[model samples]
Every structure is written in structure tokens, then in C-alpha cells.
Target: MAITTDKMEGTVKKELHVFYVLDTSGSMSGAPIGALNDAMRSTVEELRKKDGEKADLRIAVLEYNSANRWVTQGNNGVENLQDFFWTDLQATGLTYLGGALKELNTSLSRNEKMKAETGNKVPVVIFMSDGYPNDDWQEGLQVLAENKWYRAAIKIAFALGDQADTEVLAKVVGVTKQGQIVPNYEAVIKTNDLQAFSNMIQVVSVSASLAASSSQMLGTEVGAETIVREAAGEGANTDENGVVIVDATSAGGDIYASDATADDLDGFDVI
Candidate 1:
């Protein structure tokens, strides 16, 4: 898909930037990568369906393995949802999460990708990873933490499967609205089921976008807590055909469980 660079100008609508930081490491080479691709395509499609008049929703996708790359590189690394396109990402190499974090920090700057424009809403950053970082992720996170936008942005993380390090994810998604530098473990949703992972991606993305876009008008804080609470609510009423969402805090392990006939192994392709 071609990456477009045009931005909507002279519009009264507020801009809601949604950043997706994805892990495409060697460990995600098979089924995990496939599920991620499917989920992202669906999520973007749903976001595009939203009323454009409400908010000028923008999306940025950053994928990291041994190196980090922007899938949506035009328009200061973010593009309007209506113009953005999804290209399937291949998984390989180590998980260089630290590098990705540093790159994200650069983009979040007002002098760079995130411009200081009127009607700019608080950005929403969603991170997904299935393994521990092989680089100095904490240092990169520290640099990001110093950014005003990073501190105020609505952050959420997904620990995909047992191999994922929830503790690390907790640190990345720090306390929302609170000035203290504390990890928000409640913001990390751990799931082993590929179907459920895919479903949760959409649920969280849609819910966060809706909440963040209108948060200022509602006089509420747009944070991971709001997103996680909405996701848990959706999970409680998930249909039989849908995957059951569980909270990692309550489940003590995985955040999703399914009794569907499909074999768990079949959900992820062996590379």
C-alpha cells in the first residue's frame, strides 16, 4: 500500500493521534504475526468507519525487530485513518524494543512529528510484545518518560502469551494522570489465545480512540485505566462466538480463555 502524506488543514475538528507500537521479532514469525496482521487491518477498518467530523483521527504504526520501522511513514509518521493502509509485516530478528522506544520518543516531540497545533487531543499509544527486550529498553523508556507528550499520552500494553514479560510492559505503561512514576500493572493485558488477542486489539483500540477523542470535552482524563475498564466490561459480555477476556490481575496468568473447537495450536502457524 502506498503511504500518503497529505494532512487536513484549516479544519475545526480536533486531532486524535493513535500510535501502535508492534513487535515483529523472530519469535512472532508464524501464527502470532499472522494474527497481528489480521487484527491491525480490522482495527484500522473499524477506526475509518468512525465519523470524521467528530475528530480527525490519525494513526501511526511502528514495528520493531532487530530494528524499528514505521509502516505509516508519511505525514510526520502519522496519517489520517481514511488514507492509511495496512501492509502485512514479516517477523524476524531480535526484539530491539529500546530502539523502538527512542524512536517513538522522537516522534512524540512537538518540534517533530507531533506538532503543537490547536485542537490536538492527547495521543493514545498502544504497545504489543511477546518477549523480553534484548536491548536497554529501560533507558529508552526513561527518555520517553521525560517527554511531556509521553507522560500525558494514554498508554496501554499487551503481553502476548506466557513468554511475554508483563513486568516490562507495566513499566512502559506508567501511571495515568498521576504524577508519580509508578508502573500500572492493571494496564497490561496478557493473553495466550490468538483469537482473543486479535479481538482485544480491536476492542482496546476502538474504546481508547472513542474515549480519548472526547475526553477533553467530557472533562475526564484519558488514561489506560479507562481503556482497561472498558475492555473488561466488553469481555464480561463477550458472545459465545467471541473470545472471553480476563483480567491478568484477577486470572493470575493469561487474560483470555476460550472453549472453541479450534485447536489452540492451529491458531498460530509454526514457522
Candidate 2:
């Protein structure tokens, strides 16, 4: 008789933390809110499908209305994407964007929301808002800008409606070390086109998931900006200053790229 032996090995996969910072203020009610809920549901389904094939995906959700609240609790608060339970959001109250940012800044540390896994890829933050902050958002934003995780992570932001704070959203994502800003979807999405908006969200989520799962693809580091821009397709348009613009067709009439020129904003950095 021959002796038989069994051996086991453990492999630790890198975790990819995805955070959704949503605005559920009263203005998002009706059609806008409905579309957002539907889109998020689809996003969850898409992530779950890619869960096993990709990085160890985890998700955390934050909502701001009258005040900031964690829809999904803790620093290690995220559940595996495959097992995530997304509670549909309802639109109500004020847009306390500052409060939400403050909480996120606090949670960005390794001791908080980032306290999971021995090694992980940079976190991905998807933020959306349809209006201006009703509170002192500048202070909170300052803290966020100072956060190492926030600066190093992949950041994506969407300006949902015409009244949405596009300028502020741009600032929140900031400029990459290479002087590139994180993918800002303000211009590409129409204010009221819920279908288009939803599609953009799903595309961005899936793209980020795939990119974060690996260290390199196509001879380039799969950073947040790279994945976002790739996922945006024709919907993505950025001018010389790196600010994404609305499609020419959506901007009243068609404007040819060859005929366009960069805006000379002496002291401004557009997102």
C-alpha cells in the first residue's frame, strides 16, 4: 500500500472597498429618486456577478438628507458585494453634504471604515448629489482633502440635476498627482435623463470592480481615473483643462471638437 498525504495552502486576496455616498434629500423625490433606486439595484446585481471573479469586493453606503446616516455601518462596515443587501433609498429632508463628508473623512482611516484585511487596493468612492450643501461644507471638504486615503483612493462624483453643485463636486474629487481629476460625470449626464444616468452608474461600478481586481492591465496601472474614463465611452468628454463637458448635442447644438478651444480660467482648475 502506498502512503497518501494531503496539503492545504491559504491565499489572501486583496480587498477592494467601494463606498457609495448618496444624497437622499427631498429634491431627489419623484422620477429622479425612482431611477436612482433602480440603477443601484442593477449595480448591486452587476457587482455580485463579478464578485467571485474579481477582487474581494466589499461595499459601504452613506446617505445624507436632514443629517448624515450610515445606511451600512462601520469602517469594516462593507459587506462582500455578493452578499450586499441594498436598502432602497427614499428622498426627504435637507442636503447636508458637509455632514456626510465629515463622517466619511473620519471613516477613511485604517482604524475606521478601512480596518479590514491585511492588504487591500485603494478604496473607490462614488458620490452623487442634486443640489448645493445646506451646511458649512468647506470645512468638511478640507478634512477630506487632507485624508491620505481620500487623496490616494479612486473618487468619482455625479451632479444629478441642473442645480447640483458641479463646482463643489469637482473639488471633492480633486486633481490626481498627474494633474488629472478623478472622473467627474457632471457634463456627460443629462439632468433629467434617468435612464442615461442609471446606465452610467452601472458602467462605472463594473469597470472599477474589474480594474481593482488586478495590479495591471494593458501595461498601465488600473487607477480610478483610468477605469472611469474607459467606462464612460462616448459619454466622456474632457477639455484641455481636464474638465468634462456635456456632449455638444446636449449643449443646445452640436459643437465640433476642432472648433472648440479651452476656456482661459486664469486661476481655476476645472474638474
Candidate 3:
């Protein structure tokens, strides 16, 4: 008889935490909320199949409306992807996005939520919103900026519809090491179609997980920037239904690219 062991034992797996900062304001009620709930359930199912030797995938969800709340904080503030469950969210009240940002800042700290003794990768944060914030979002963002974990995390944002504040979403996702807002590097994806919105959530979640779980050599570009570039690249323009996936020109110029010239991005609009 042959015996095979799954592991030698005493091995600590590297952890890759993914946070979904969702908006559940009154504006997201009706069809929007239904689509969001369905999308989140499917997204979680997809993530379950992504755990690998490089990193053990974990997930956290924070939803905001009149207040912010965590859906997966029962077990050390994060749960393994395979064990996580998606509960359908109800939408109502004001869009207090600023308070959500501050809440996330607290969770991202080493002492509070992320207290792993070994092998901790930079977290991936996905923010989604459909309307303007009703609170002091700028101050909340400013507070989050001071956290080393937030500064290093891979950040992406989604403008759900025409009513969404893309410029504010851009600022939320695109903060340079020097504390500058380079809109191009922000990865603010916009889609008005509900199906397209669902597709984008899956695409970005998978792409970012693949990137963040891999090992990067020294001086490599940020994972979020690479995700945006590939998403906006030529020939990858639309989803299966032919809805435009990303508008690179409007997204901003390449970040940390030395060969990029002013003429190459002449007509691009930043915002």
C-alpha cells in the first residue's frame, strides 16, 4: 500500500484577502439590487475554485447605506473562499460611503483585522457605487490614505450607471505612492447595463485574484494597473453582448511607464 500526505504539516499558507466594498443605498433598490445580489452569489462561487498553493484565498464583504456593516466578520474578520456564503442584501437609506471608507480603514489594520503572523499578501479592494455619497467621503478617504495597508492594496472601482460619480470613484481607486491622483491608474470601470455590470464584477474579481496571488519580482508595476490595461487593451473591448467593456482613453495614461509620451495620449480625457 502507498500512503500520500496532503502536506508535511506545519506549513503556513500565504493569505490573499479580497474585500468587496459595496453600496446598498436607496438608489440601488429594485432591479439594481436584484442584479447585485445575483452577481455577488455567482462571484463568490467562482472565487471558491481559485484557492491554490501560492496563496489561500479569503474574502470579506462590507456593505454601506445609512451605515456600514460587515457580512463576513464572524471568523477572524475574513473567511476562506470555500467556506464563505453570500447573503442577499436589501437596499435602503442614504449613501454614506464616507463612513464605509473609515470602517474599512479600521479593518485593514494589522492589529484589528489582519493579524496574520506570516505570509500576508497585499489585499485587493473592490468598490462599487451607483450614486453620489451623502456623507463626507473625502475625509473618509483621507483617513484611509494614512493606512499602509490601504496604500499598498490593489484598488478598483465601478461606476454602476450614469448617476454614479466617476470622478470621485477615480480618486478613491487611484492614489499614487506620492499621494497624487492619476486618473488613468485608478481603474474606474463604468457600465450602465445590469448584465454588463455583473460580468465586469466577475472579470475583475478573477483577474485581480490571479494577479495578487502570484509572486512579483522587485520594482514591478501595481497589479491593479495591469488589470486596467489588459481590460482596456485593443480587441478586448466588449462583453459577450457587445457592451463596451472599458474606455482606456477616458481611464487615464499608463502609470509608471517610461516610454509613454504626451502625443500617445494626446486626446485622452482624464476624469
- What's model 2's lDDT at 70? 79
**Model 2 lDDT tens row, 122-142:** 788888888998988877887
Which candidate leads the pack in lDDT? 1
In candidate 3, stretches whose alpha carbon ends up further than 4 angstroms from where it belongs are 1-12, 181-186, 213-222, 232-271
Please name the candidate that would achieve the greatest TM-score relative to the true structure.
3
> lDDT values of the candidates?
0.78, 0.71, 0.77
Model 2: ten consecutive residues of lowest lDDT: 250-259
For model 1, the local distance difference test gives: 0.78
Superpose all Cα atoms of candidate 3 onto the true structure and report the RMSD in Å to 1 decimal. Answer: 9.2
Descending-TM-score candidate ranking: 3, 1, 2
Residue 184 lDDT in candidate 2 = 47
Ranking by lDDT: 1, 3, 2
Error of 1 at 221 (Å): 6.2
Name the runs in model 2 displaced over 4 angstroms: 1-10, 74-76, 175-191, 213-221, 235-271
lDDT of 3 at 178: 58
